[model samples]
Target chain A: MAKELTPQEMLRIDLTPPNKDWMDIPTVIKPGIYCYPAKPEKVEIVGMPNPHVWSPLDDDWGLPEDWKETFLEGMRERLNKHRSFKIFMDICVRCGACADKCHFFLGSGDPKNMPVARAELIRSVYRGEFTKAGKILGRLAGGRKITEDVLKEIWYYMFQCTECRRCSLFCPYGIDTAEVTIIGRELINLFGLNINWIQEPVANCYETGNHLGLLPHTFKQNIEFMCMDIEDFVGVTIEPPFNKKGAEILFVTPSGDVFADPGIYTLMGYLLLFEHIGLDYTWSTYASEGGNFGFFTSLDMAQRLNAKIYAEAKRLGVKWILGGECGHMWRVVHQYMNTFNGPPEFLEEPVNPLTGTKFENAKSAKMIHISEFTADLIKHGKLKLNPKRNDHLKVTYHDSCNPSRGMGMFEEPRYIINNVCNNFYEMPENTIREQTFCCGSGAGLNAGENMELRLRGGLPRANAVKYVHERFGVNMLSCVCAIDRAVLPASMEYWVPDVNVCGVSELVGNALIMEGEHDRPTDLRGEEIPGFAKAEGEEEVTEDV
Target chain B: MGRNLHKGLREILVHKKGPIVEKWRELIHKSYPPETAQFLKREKDRFSNPIGSSIEDSIWPLFDQLIGEADPSTTKKLLDNLVRVRAVQDFTPASAVQIIFALKQIVRKEVLPAAQKKGLLREYLEFESEIDRFGLLAFDVFMECRERVWEIKRNDLLKRPYLLAGGMCPSYMMKRGIKHLEKLKKEITQH
Candidate 1:
């Protein structure tokens, strides 16, 4: 006879919450979820406070002796300095409108990951420490003292946010929840609790002028290697100048484009496009990075890293600056760069030398995005584009969170795609445009140890791609972001293996019909063009037969 | 293998498919927090609530495959859709596949009475055994997804050796007492 289960035992899998409130639920820091803590040396290099070795898994994080006072003091300082932070904390009515909008919440199904609750993790402490009624009434007034566990919980969820601002878009009162997370991270960094994936990049960007810390020679050599590939594949020999003074424009891009795959192809696209137009621009080794990891750490650090861009431009005496395909780089540049390091008085307003169109939108920053430049060029019929070159690719666009929401660059990339790729499709309306989902690995959260978090957060974006893949046979997903180029390939491979990720410039490079070029046998990646090269297995099958 | 027994089990499973799938989905929804479970249950749009929509879109075809033909290819694809979502979520390996086992309980409650009256209780026991096998298959798919996640993590690290090489910053090298910064830089360049 088989054993029988009792009535209570029969239904063993119970997932309901405990009798205690969410505040009482202790955070369990799991491996493969949190990133490695920042190294002490990296922290010390930046002269940040309380440099020490620590782990999220440790019972004691080895915080400074005055950690509580330091945290409260930081919070008080932020509340005084940034009125937006103070208003965001005070204005939220617990509307829950932004609760379901977070990708982390949607992916993980954790209530704490909800924007409202995540904010309340800090808000509760604020009320307890700052408000008179809360100090008097305690838990009755929806306030709690900042225990070590509370600090731990705040740190856990703050880093979980990508600061993509998706949730902020949905907030009725315009809470700007990303700012809350930014301030939360700033406070966390006061104790040197930053993650290595972010801190190392910040230190490297400060010391060597790029996130990957490639020295001037190595950076130039990497671009030269890409030039060699362009020569081999496109039958065009080009020498892109580096740090050349008196150039008309200073072209800066995230260093990922120089060193990483897919992004390097986009860099190749930039080289080809510039060469085709005979535009005068120089790459700066000092401002090699456009993306700022310091933006994820703190505002002051972001300003420090971002100062190099304008400084390089002033030194080079370029007329204007043109930025490349990157996500947060644009967010920082468009929204915060001018405020951080500008009134770039040394530079002139950005004007498309090829099209002769003055970019009024970028007049203040004296910087223009690559898509803005390319779109203007195409609109004016400046380039001879062959859309048929991309016929083999059925393409779709992923509105990288920053460019879409932060910059409102909705039509430029799509207009460029229409001119380049014949088979362009939109994902479901809700998942695109201003409502675009994050690639999940934004901010500094795109580290290897946080793979589970990234994958779960990426599901919505990947699911939208899957829908288009099934409906429209969309195989290639393009975007105007280098971080997307770096991370989306892994997400696409995991969620929808059929779709491949690429930069928009890669598509432009494919469709570009350069003067004095040989009959192109391949795209920028050296994969054969559909009509140019023989189909796969055709000759082999004939030989076998 | 008896023809009448197969016919009886198929008819009962097909007739009770609606309630069976609903109860199974409800149990799966329970696996999340109460507020999120309510949201996932209430929201019907596929794009706005993909997690919910994936569960809804998959369970119907999954049930049909379970009761009708049990085609391995179709069933595996359907299971992959559902299991892949849960694999990256905050579930342990056992809890991740436990959703499949909920169907066993649902069947025992919904089909047991009818099967007993129709003299098909033994067939029902065999059917439960089939559910056990399906649970085992779901476990395999879950593990495959978990392994793929690890593979992706490993590949991401390998793809960006510069990040790790850069991690050996000059100050970090000094702190670690590694004197050969030049050697490490050479290796990174070669890599």
Candidate 2:
């Protein structure tokens, strides 16, 4: 059952700002709007502060005895440590350019979900405590004390943000809301408060080297299981090397690829592509997950989980790392990995063996996104592609936020998609590339109780997809993010029913003509490939769309 | 009781149609942020003010469709653009469809005085059922939209139960289930 918000609340068209102070406008902490709390044990495992039973929906979340002091102190430390925090705090002109750009604000119509307003949630607190104007002229200076209402508002709106940074792209000062939210969330986590969706994965990634907490044997068996699918469907025997010593490259992918359905197909695509080129890479159970869920919470957690990739690569004696197609993983590995983990002096810069092209951007880090690798291979005419195999799919590409905005590797994915799929249509120019809307559930906010919020926040993305789907007869929404793979399917189902969601690599697997493969009568999902059934001398039924 | 309630309901639906439509549109328009709402509240042009246009398209036709005749297709066609926007909004099924019933409230306030004055209780009662029927139809559209929401979720789950199926710890069992489904799909397609 959907929780009800009055039409006046959701769609009130009044233009005037309330005469009352913002904090004076009462905050209703709605159920199914916020995530469940992290278990105390999980908080303990991560050694995060304020480990205790609590709920965001409750009036009194279990907090430290001096939670206010702790929060202010933590804010002070973060402000001193990171200059961006101080600058972002002081520099907001609140021009409102970034307001309508947010998918959450556009979808839910919650004014605070707007980037400027969301930033103001934290900025207000900063104004009250840190700034002189805020201290003296509190409410007038947009300063609100860190009261329980403000704290609850912080939890509600901060988690609501996907940290997609679409707002930053439009900001006159390039003020990244993700950085603000990241610091804001980290400050919140000082109370040992984290949502289970984020904390559980962070805990699991810490303990099991992956988010799903797959045991070493279970991890190995899962990869082997997908290989069997390849053998059965494609008739290609792919013995993907697992922790093989002295491999040329260490391939790290999000464990969602190995565990989930559409993502598993993408994982299969990686294996087939690797085997096709006789890629010198090994899959490490230790460095299995490329997605750093800790990234959603704090930089320290991201650093801890990301440490596995370089450690395993060093141990395996691999030259460089070839990252799988994932969203925030690329954001982390490309931007934050080197800074947090270190200069991996052991691994050489990523090189395409066929084209002998060195990835100069990844020279210091020595890691390249799989799209970059695949596009280079395709450009050099390395792998034989049969694009017509994907003709059944009138496809549209969803640019995952982090990679498109964070790394700006915009062309690489489209290049691969165009090469692999024939009937590809770009989602509207404004919605695609840098100005992309989040799938509404990035940053580990994909839990079920919050499904209504997720669906609402996802409307802009879904609406854009609907335009392409209705116009181009687009049936598939493809992206490079595992979170998108996990969440966009639900968004598509809710908004645009006929369209399906998949990873870009899943398209690659379908179109790829494997060496010594059984005529892929079906795509990796076992659905009949459009024209393949008719060609197989079966009843010439209308091809499944 | 039923006769009295029906008469009371009808008095509003027929006599107060104008105010009812105005109030309903006002509520829908108010759904946007204050700035957007202020412009949308006044903007009369359909092109410049699509929200205004949508209201004109959905509400006026909706009133005629409900009060004039039982043309479901024409009514649906008229309301589809407007309701679909609401359907995707961050609304509960109740709130999303509740806008449909705001007319009934306006009908009560506007038509009640006239019905009592004219002693047209019987005639007024007839309009009551008519608007109820429209409310039912509005519910039908809302439910269908909601059903599609759930259907999309169910269909996605059906497409790949593997999301929940995995981490259940029996690796071979999940594989067998996948293999079984693949074979079933293959057989169905073959047929």
Candidate 3:
């Protein structure tokens, strides 16, 4: 018989963070980690190796004869290019103020995981190799030599860290441990030893359109399935436009949302809402995933992944793309993409085709969040919502980190939740809104092996949420990010057992007004929201917000 | 038994206290430009009030304790001042290439060994060869230390107080370095 899956055991094997530290590490491992079962392997999946994992160095996985020269040159380049690196190198007071902050340290009880000590792993070597005191008065003076062993330890320890940057917040000088991890990863990549797991997803993203390796046809099939789900779940033949040329708005979502549960539910809400509103929108299988794992790996990979959006949008000749709720996707678009990809000439500045109000010079492409769009429609009296349809469960919204911190998307989702749900309680401030914690599985560490770390990492968020669930009787955890749907459920199932996770759209789908022949009387227990009939006056359009 | 020693070593570093802190105004003046430093010092009461004392007053006890505890073998205090002179022989060059050069010297020779003897070195140097191979140089020291840390025998190393003491060593000590008596005192006692 197959061994029974204990929460701890399954979490260790599935989540990719090193397993040895999970039980003993000082950090309290939250139940939120290990959100999914590890995919069973039959024949090992073979992927093409990208020869360009390293830049300005030899491509081999081992040190070449000129390794020292390569290493020095790489260090000099990093020092010259990033002021953050220089500040990091110069400013660590090693006061150990950041020691208690790392979840890995708390979970593993390994002193090496302590942020200050972890930094010293690099700082000591940098001092020993680059400066005068380091050369002669080595260990006593604070200098440490970088040997082959040091490199391997760096690979092992640095990779274990999630690059959360929480440590940086408390740090007096703002030393980003994530930067150190990136530099370490860059060095290891120089050696060509990017293990098969992470590299495979990156490779798949390059070959197929998504990290999950779903081809365009498969992607289209999933979208069609979501439309079918909308028909079944909410009584409407909600036809979603896929790959339609010259649509007013091109809707792009993470492909995972199309294939998964609550995410698919959110997608269904969008389809039904769009159909009811008579809005022109299309879903692109080409730009399927808004959540880019490439941003986590390298700057170049990030650029490559983002470059696809413009390519597909231009091909479709759409005006202003609408991005789905994803953490890093919003971060990349808001922080980097608008500047990186220019002259969105393929899409004109979004004009309220209804209001004729042009949103020019929008910081983020005039792309509207679905939550904001839905809430706006509600505010304009476009949809008649029965909030009592969602009265069965008390729901609370968990802010996706990128939208909360990356873009100031605090209000939109909450607006939808308040308008649609009969009862909604706010998660404690420490765990919600701008200070919201990650789902413990964002940034593609959602694999089975890293689940324990995810749980451990997500403890702070889980604990805060659990307090409300225990005291306030909150039953649902709602968020906008698809990955939150994927990861937070597992976390909630384990740690905060009182709550079930749902999308803001799932609630909207539950309460959405399906327009009828005439304005009908609204009832709490038994009537469907008015269903959508074709809108009149398409000939002489008037847009009023 | 060895693991117990390792555990003991960790305790030493974890428990080690640094110098009793003194002279915050002087130290603040050293890191920041005069205007910023003066403003910070003026606003020192604002920071220290909730925490109990001015950063200048608060940090001194810790600094002085670390300085007082530093091994006399390596660091020598001046007759009239709290400034401890680290002997620049065998490890650090007498003429520094840069300010960090002096730090590299003090860390590799005096600070690291004191840490090592007390079992604190394990955190900084996991392998025996890390101590051996990265024989006290700047970038190369980091390089060698990196190599040494990966050595298999590093698994067997003990955690000690000297290693813990290293944790108390400020980031400044590894950079431009203990230019003043108060900084020296803080560094000595903090561990």
Best by DockQ: 1
lDDT of 2 by residue, B92-173 (tens): 5556666665665666677767776777767665666766666566667777776766655444444444444446533354
lDDT per model vs. reference: 0.87, 0.79, 0.55
- lDDT digits (tens) for residues B1-191 of candidate 1: 12233678878988999999999999888888788898899888888787898889878897776666677777778788888988998886778888887888898899899989899888888777777777888888998999999888866754454334543332222223223544555576799
Docking quality class, candidate 3: incorrect
Question: Which regions of candidate 1 deviate over 4 angstroms?
Answer: A1-20, A534-545, B1-5, B162-191
Which 10 residues in a row give candidate 2 chain A its minimum summed lDDT? Answer: A13-22
- Per-candidate TM-scores read 0.93, 0.85, 0.61
Clash totals in order: 0, 11, 139
Candidate 2 wrongly placed segments (more than 4 Å): A1-21, A534-545, B1-26, B32-95, B103-132, B143-191
Q: Write the per-residue lDDT of candidate 1 for residues A320-397, one digit (tens) a residue.
A: 999999999999999999989997988999889877899999989999999999999999999899999999999999
Model 1 CAPRI quality = acceptable
Show where candidate 3 strays beyond 4 Å. Answer: A1-72, A95-111, A131-137, A140-143, A172-175, A195-197, A343-346, A351-361, A364-368, A516-545, B1-191
The alpha-carbon lDDT assigned to residue A169 of candidate 1 equals 88
Model 1: DockQ vs. true structure: 0.33
Q: Candidate 3 lDDT, tens digit per residue, A1-545?
A: 12355777544421112333221222322222222211112002322122333211222324566766666676777777878876797778888667755645433334566777777777777788877888899876677776655654555555556555556656887687767766765555554445433555565667676666667776776666555545444546666778899888888777656655456667666666677778888888778777666666555567777778878888888878777767767777777787667546556776555445454534345565666666666766777787876776788888887777666788878888898887899876655665566676565565444444555455556656666787788888988887788777766654566787778877786677776412322211123433322245534323551
- Looking at chain B only, the TM-scores across the models are 0.82, 0.63, 0.23
DockQ values, each candidate: 0.33, 0.18, 0.01
Model 1 RMSD, rounded to 1 decimal: 6.2
